[model samples]
Target: MTATRAIVVMGVSGSGKTSVADGLAAALGTAFIEGDSLHPAGNVEKMSRGVPLTDEDRWPWLDTIGQALAGSLDAGKSVVVSCSALKKIYRDRLRQSAGGALTFVFLKGSRDLLTARMAARHGHFMPASLLDSQLATLEDPSGEAGVVTVGIDAAVETIVARALDGLKTVG
Candidate 1:
């Protein structure tokens, strides 16, 4: 990984993006941003109501994430962000906004595992019902440049380690 790369931990709901990204930022000695926290109120309301956000709803949120990444990079600090980033266009938008100095850690998992994980969570605005919509929106980033694809079936530590190992090859 480069000295100042902005890393995005990406996947559908319940894929452990937060746990992994937090670990990754700690391991890298950088700051971590929870992408969901940056969502506008309206977007959060929609999701909390079990409604999938439209592309119109996502652009502003994506831009906010991008700005956060860019701001951190401008301060010469490496940063890790947790985001769904479910589509290629969304990733591309982030890449552009971060001036191309971005890497993504894509958490890949089976639907059954993801559903189970979502069901076990509590107090989150996102509902397990929205998992299918997120899965449908996801465009696998496996072959994309600057992307590290890691399986999410392991313990958080193991998964973070795997992601760290994978990030080593990102340019």
Candidate 2:
């Protein structure tokens, strides 16, 4: 078996993090964790009400994701997780928790495209109203080590393929 790797599919809410991460996990034959599902109930409620989460509100959630990644890596298992790791600090936290063996696949897209995608979605806790907040908070990870930036303008399969190819360079 290939050595275990920890990967985070990160982007704004509408940037297809879930789909791409799911595909990536399947391709890698690893567990798929939806980071949003690990959020505290209060945080979900706040987002469901269209309220932007403060940094304080996000710390615990980020910690939870980090712990999940760390646990998988410690068990010698590859894992893919979906997270809107918009800020550099959040990504750094995840890296530290995962013992620095982490790579991120950043899904990039234009604002117009993201807004349209958010608008078309249904039954999601995050509202389109929070997209601006998320975009504002996003720190582009393009030049960061262990980071792969894949444009979200293509189909999910293409995006996943691009991410896999990019991972070859960083992983």
Candidate 3:
């Protein structure tokens, strides 16, 4: 098994965060956290109504995720968490909260691919309309500390395998 560490599966909506995160957790023999579940009820409601969350709307929820990441690490366990950490600042906040190093797996894909994926998705609160906003918000993580980028233009299994490989390589 890999060492106990937080692996944040980050990407825009429809970038296969859940599937990749789940695969990573299973591969790493660790726990998995769906970050959207940590959102406040109001946040969910707002997003469901097509309103994008502002920083104020996200702070408390981000704090929750940070705490969970820190707590899990303190307990000597690894976790794979899925979060749309679109901006560098958000990633910084999460990394600080983890209280240790975070290995972020950034799922990168084209706008067309993402749009198709989002359109095909069912039962997700985020609408396909939000993709452009998210894409605009994303600050490329190129050469950032403790981060690895993986292309989402492949099969889930291939993506997972590549991510695991990348993790090993980066570490």
Q: Provide TM-scores for the models.
A: 0.98, 0.98, 0.97
Q: Summarize candidate 1's per-residue lDDT along 71-133 as a digit string, tens digits.
A: 998999899999999999999999999999999999999999999999999999999999999
User: Relative to the true structure, how large is the alpha-carbon lDDT of every model?
Assistant: 0.95, 0.96, 0.90
Which 10 consecutive residues of model 2 have the lowest summed lDDT?
1-10
The digit string of per-residue lDDT tens for model 3 on 34-106 reads 9999999999998888888888998898889999899999999888899988888899999899875788999
Alpha carbon lDDT of residue 128, candidate 2?
Answer: 98
Tell me which of candidates 2 and 3 scores higher on TM-score: 2
What's the TM for model 2? 0.98
Q: By how many angstroms RMSD does model 3 differ from the true structure?
A: 0.9
lDDT of 2 at 166: 94
Pairs that collide in candidate 2 are none
